[model samples]
Target: MSSKILTCSVLSALATAFLLDWYHKKFEVTTPPTKNTPRKPRKYDDSLIREQLSRNYSFLGEEGLGKIRNTFVVVVGCGGVGSNCIISLIRSGISHIRIVDFDQVSLSSLNRHAVAQLEDVGTPKVECLKKHILRIAPWVTVETHNELFDINNAQPLLMDGNPDYIVDCIDNIDTKVDLLSFCCERNLKVVSSMGAACKSDPTRINVGDISCTEEDSLARSVRRRLKKRGVLKKIPVVFSSEKPAPGKASLLPLPDEEYEKGKVGELSALQNFRVRILPVLGTMPAMFGLALATYILCDIADYPMEPIVGKSRTKVDGIIQSLAGQQSRLGNTEQRIPIPNNDIIYIVEEIFRGKSPISNYSTRLTLSQWDPAKKLSLQNIVVMTKEEQKLHEQRVLKGGEKLESVYPPEVIQLVEKRFAEEKFYSQFR
Candidate 1:
């Protein structure tokens, strides 16, 4: 009886101790402020929150914009076209961009390029443009590559980012071809801008399926090369239909040293009526950039726009004709000129026979001529022909049905040899 009573007494004492410790913690947590202490109220910055909310809500109506914010675009030039494109893309809410360009900001670029400020003259274009993008959209993620796009590095650069779209604003034909071919082979959607120089009219620009002609100077060269490799049919391009202006003869030719050292004022004074830079030339790049952005947005919204076909002139005609002849050509094959091969002798003979004439050339070139230095190869020989000289074009387009092959084995061997020789020279340089 005494033992049981002692156990009960110990249990009571332990329970009381535990309750006292719990009570002390509870008192500390609920303690009221002393009379001398001052209380601080929670604060909210309404203006800052309102600003952020406004930006986010602006896109609430645009499902396309929301989709675009998640996509990545790789632009391969940072000059006039590229800078404008990047800036526009950022402003449109594209948060991811990879820019590649090896050029430095030049004084001449300040006239039209978006990011070419006076202070950025010597800075690399990629770096300067990236800084500008960050300033415009702090949330944007931009990667800069200060290098030329080439076969050796293009694949890795493209694959590294896994870009959803590629914009080609590059001027070099070889580089453009390399990138286009790479993109096509990888099945990546891409858009390209052809020569914007010497073009004045912005309305002439159009994007579309690459025509089947070997007549556009740049397009012809690209088509011929791609044809040889069976890649021509797969590539799509955007190009201008306006012809470049004719060359002018200068009476008082400046010396090379003087030409190189001329200031902006001096250069302006020497400009002849035949040679001038149009403000529209700069605007065309921006126009192309917008087209690229539109393509991206359309793709994300599941409303793909139809590719433009041929040059704008022919394309417009086709549209009108299609509306009229909609039923007659229901299953007809799309009309396209045949790709040409390098064979100067055959081309000349065909032209002399009146089977092919130079009139088939695109509007981009008013005059095309063979350069002995540049056209040593038969393939290049075809490229050097005048706009109206069509011996080669006739055989490829009309006589293709009758002719066995415009590019026989011998012609192919000659072209390969010339290309190898050119490559060898390039390696040493």
Candidate 2:
């Protein structure tokens, strides 16, 4: 009787298990899907994208909007500045972009990142940006690179898209220099963001050539490094002109336990990366990023923007003083310079674009008469390095030689092109 009972109990348990399994399969197959079921991806809608960008189209017009749609942009660094920049770019009708970043999102990033959330922590930043981009601009073609942008991998990362503009938001000094040096060497149009950390005043933000950037330590470091690499050409950059208040902010010290370890550098995310964190106000970087986007859009759309030229009035006077001294030594008694004192900055920055057309050198530059016979005027003044000016004095001005005889055809052509552009631009003035 006991044996019979045990066998019956085992049979009952087996039947229950079998029934449970069968019921699961039956419901899974027969039950209609609920709201929890993953839905198919929404199809791309061209009209929707256009309608969403209607305000941008209204602002930029048909030709500008068309250019924006066709343009490809590359953004290196998916942190504060870069994230905001790419967001603006996408919303403004940038159809294609390649985002390169080697960092994973951290909880700290939520304070400043454009689209990061609590769930995005520990994921690659480029992936986060791309995912967010798809949600708003589904038709946008996004290429992501989850790796460090260094000299070794920069070419492929930067050149693969054949981007019309490269926005450099990299914070690492060495990597920043490497990217800028590469772009400068390749003659690639790029705009870089200087240090926005430790700054809070948004009014001080300025966009100008890297040489003209002041009060930002990161810009100074980058400028110094680029100069070491023989890159003296003008590099457009968005930088803050506000000086950081002393004792207001600084790099956070490492924890005692971490400092006890001999390898502090190893503690960084990557080798040679900064272990200490710079205190960031968060809002400053957004301003920098927005400024970058505005500048790039204006540039792409052929919209005219006369940015505040980077130096102070005193600096402009210094340049004039240098030019005057050069003139005085030449012994030409033209009692007064034909060029207005206020117009010197325009001539140097606008007409010549703040660099010598001959060697592309930016330092020690001053205005010089292109032709001795022509009176000093907007059309006659040209930008040249001090050395080039001395040579011009010896050959063209004093020796009575023609410009074409002394300078190469390429140089003459570039100067002439600048003059022609000035002639057209002057109409607006």
Candidate 3:
């Protein structure tokens, strides 16, 4: 009886303890946030926050909006193209930008450069542009490098923030080449601007296959120099080739001329020549800049590559047949085959239209009858003697004549068809 009474007492004690713990939790009084403590403002009720978010969504849709807001773009020149590109990137919702340049704003720069203003004169391009960007997007992270991009400093500047894309707007050819090689070696994607100095026609400006040559003088010179170095053989480039109007000789000495002058004494008398500067408004650079930004964004978003439009190659084939007398007895003697003149044309037609060749060339060749017995039968023979071969080599070496299309016609046709079919998706994908 005593053991049963002890067990009942212990059970009652355990139930009493459980009731005490439950009572503490059920009727507890909690302290509110202290006066000194801070609370995060609700994002939904903030109009500024809502507007920024809406802009991001409107510019870069839901799928890639986050990526764009987080991306870093390094623009390597604050001249015409760089300034325009940076502005477009900011307006497109890109939140991080780095401007690198060693130039100071001058009076002449105000006419063409987007970010150059009267008040910005004498200021470093990088600093001035960063200030402009901050004014537009205060939340954006803007960094500036007031140094020229050279072999020694390029690597660090390029790799510093782990840039997602690099835009080349440098004017010097050697510098541009160095930047391209550096980016290519590091496997970083980059887009470069070609000669935009002397062109005026906006319609003539275009982005296209880098292999094809345009008739513009600046492009030709660039192509020659780049080809000599084997750089333009495969690198994709964005350039315009519209011929500039003839003007007075240039007053501003070439970069090489300046170097030579530095080697010599400044007292040496060198006649200054006056050259015409191309009239560049905001439209062409703006268009190309936006296109470049679109390409970069599309790449980051895992979209299909956009086809660069360029000159198309057109080829024509003709067969010549000799007339025979009706009901006449045929001779068994070796029949003679006549040669038909053939021509190939390389044309820069409108990207939308598929008709008309821009340039044409005709060449004549000797023809021979096909032989079934031979493994490789002769159909049309070009019996170019040694002298002809020597002349052809001479012309090629002298760069007297442009070659026929560098690519096959069928390949170009296939590419054009693919471009047309996938163009819409490429724009926003």
Candidate 4:
């Protein structure tokens, strides 16, 4: 009985101690400040920043490093790519940056977010980035905006600061289009990140114009949308040329249990915000982010790189000359189509992707009219190999055969889609 009474007393004492600690933490304030103490001015260790970036100074030279330190950059979309990019830029000596993102760190984001800790989950991504950035780059100025970047707020967020450069790491198609279009209209220097999802190869990544990027559907869509806005082929981007391994990755399918809840659209962050998530290889996004930072830093230091395009204008001229020859062979004495040289180049690079849609041949490609009855315009032209062009002329142009009769459904569908895109672009012209 004495032992039981001692146990009860000990439990009561422990509970009381726990409550006291909680109370102190929750409500107690520190000792009252002593009066008349002069507060010292806050001092930042600029020497430490220089020591931290000493290697950068050596590599970029003193003048180059100075330029980097003074340049202002705005990064939108603080997700996997954007987070890595922000940290890399800060480490590279960019003293001023504005980070824009409306997302909270989710449990799933732990896989690829550069500086997010488990404790950061449920916090805004921009806030988390700023917190960690100030720890390392205390001398740097970081502006955090925990709101989505859209047309409604683009002017003040992008233009008011006169940022030297803008980095676009957004993943949504519509949002990306809006940002890129705004940059192009305002002549703002910008570099964009293309799709890194489902990509596993680091070597396949390349820095190039949006029109030169291949094997990335996201880049293709962005390029097409930009073209519709009369902004063609100058916006730089980092994209993967590697084709996704077959059956290795895809959009995750919703389970039956999820469907039972009804209206899957409600599950998205916003309307048309991509309900399905693409499976990502975490390292790929990091590589893309680093590439973007490297590209921007070099540019800021006055050492810009000429990113490679898929086909040069000289190559386009050859294709155009070859098409003129084909028109001659078809008894059209004019030898020139109704389309302008610039429009023809756009057709070859942007629409046909610098290859034959029928045989996927990149070499010896020439354009032929899909339908002889239609006037030769952007919508009427199609790319084909030399042999394929000859056969098309014999079978369709002169033989009066329908496109459905000569081409398979897939080819027909592809040609139709290209024509529709050309028609859409015509409105902008």
lDDT of 4 by residue, 1-429 (tens): 999999999999999999999976654323422321211212467787789999999999999999999998999999999999999999999988988998999999899999999999999898788778866776777778888889999998888769999999999999999999999888999999999998887767888888777678899888888888888748889998664433568678888888899999998988778887799988988999999999999988987577655434535677777778778887889966667777776787667777888998888877888889887778889988889989999989888888898889999999888787767656645
Off by over 4 Å in 3: 1-50, 53-56, 216-234, 243-283, 303-305, 313-429
**Candidate 3 Cα deviation (angstroms), residue 419:** 32
Native-to-model Cα distance after best TM-score fit, residue 269 in candidate 3, in Å: 19
**Candidate 2 displacement at residue 405 in angstroms:** 71
Identify the runs in model 4 with alpha carbons over 4 angstroms from their true place.
1-42, 308-429
The digit string of per-residue lDDT tens for model 2 on 1-429 reads 999999999999999999999975753324422321222223557788788999988988989989999998999999999999999999899988888899999999888999999999999898788778867776787777788899999888778747899999999999999999999999898999999888887777898998887667888888998888889999999987654433467668888898787888887899888889888988888888999999999899988898984544334666666667667767866556766765787677656767999899988887787878876678878888889988888889888999999999999999988777767656645
**TM-score-superior candidate, 1 or 2:** 2
Error of 4 at 281 (Å): 0.9
| Residues 1-429 of candidate 1: C-alpha lDDT, one tens digit per residue | 999999999999999999999976653324433421212211325454335435543643356556676788888988777788788877766777888887799887786688678899998898788667755565666777877788899886687758888888886767888888888787888877665655555655666656532223667677666666567545555566543322421124445675577653445422321123433446666676666656555666566578644332222333223222321332225342121222222233222221222333333221112222342232333322232324343454333432235445664454445444434433322
List the candidates ranked by TM-score, beginning with the highest.
4, 2, 3, 1
Clashing pairs in 4: none
TM values, all candidates: 0.52, 0.64, 0.56, 0.64
* Per-candidate count of clashing residue pairs (backbone under 3 Å): 5, 0, 8, 0
261 Cα displacement, candidate 1 (Å): 16
- Candidate 2 shows a clash count of 0
Candidate models: Cα lDDT each: 0.57, 0.83, 0.56, 0.84
- Candidate 1 clashing pairs? 208-308, 351-391, 358-388, 358-389, 358-390
Q: Which regions of candidate 1 deviate over 4 angstroms?
A: 1-62, 212-216, 244-280, 307-429
Worst 10 residues of 3 by lDDT: 320-329
